[model samples]
Target: MFRNGLEPWHLLVVLAVIILLFGSKKLPEMARGLGKSMRILKAETKAMREDDAPAADGTANSTAAEQDRPAVAPVTPATVTKADEATKTNTTA
Candidate 1:
């Protein structure tokens, strides 16, 4: 039967095991990679939220750099069908 759920010593044991398995140098590299991955994930999620927000409110929420760049048209099913038809006609001809 377990008397206590978790103790400081338990954490120390886990840390010791991790250090032994990964070594000191590898742990720093792993931690750095993890930090980068976390930052990238946070940025992507924020961008997704920003993208959804503009669509929902029908307002442009863009930077000056974005405004200066030419807008790319989104592909639609109708456009795909038209393109396919054009290709087919060209192939037949």
Candidate 2:
């Protein structure tokens, strides 16, 4: 009969068993990984919710168009090394 559900001592025993199985050193690393995964999941869900919300203009099609656009990285001027400049001059001749 499950009359009384999970007292403090029950949780303590569970914690003790986990510690024995995993040891104390690995627990922190596991907890840190779990925290990071939770944060990434939360961010992704928030982004999805935002994407699902209707725009102020009441246009749902605009969101799809925006997603279709390719992301472009900014272009920077290439730095020319002395060796590259010398090679260029040799090739031009």
Candidate 3:
């Protein structure tokens, strides 16, 4: 018989359970981290939206964004010679 789906006491019980599970001392740290994460997410979403918006001078934002980002070297598979493989095998053995 779940007539009153959620009352004030129900919320209090849930809060009590959370406090019991993650102690009172850790709650503030968790809350602070959550707040920081939310702020970062908001900022990233704003930046993405700005990047999507067209410039007034008809220039693409991609060029500017690309310039701001660091270039990473492309990863290529390493070619192992028989000598190298043999050295690895020797070391392991």
Superposition TM-score, candidate 3 onto the true structure: 0.64
Residue 45, candidate 2: Cα error in Å is: 0.5
Tens digit of per-residue lDDT, candidate 1, span 12-70? 99999999999999999999999999999999999878765654556667755787999
Residue pairs that clash (backbone atoms under 3 angstroms), model 1: none
lDDT of each: 0.86, 0.91, 0.92
Give the runs in model 3 whose Cα sits over 4 Å from its true position.
65-93
Model 3, span 1-93: residue lDDT tens: 789999999999999999999999999999999999999999999998988898889986675768899989999999767988899999999
The per-prediction CA RMSD against the true structure, in angstroms, equals: 8.4, 11.2, 9.7
What is candidate 2's lDDT per residue for 1-93, written digit by digit as tens?
678888899999999999999999999999999999999999999988988888888766457778899999999999767988899999999
Q: Provide the lDDT at 58 for model 2.
A: 79
Between candidates 1 and 2, name the one with more favorable lDDT: 2
Full candidate order by TM-score, most accurate first: 3, 2, 1
Every model's TM-score: 0.58, 0.62, 0.64
Q: Judged by lDDT, which candidate is best?
A: 3
* Best candidate according to TM-score: 3
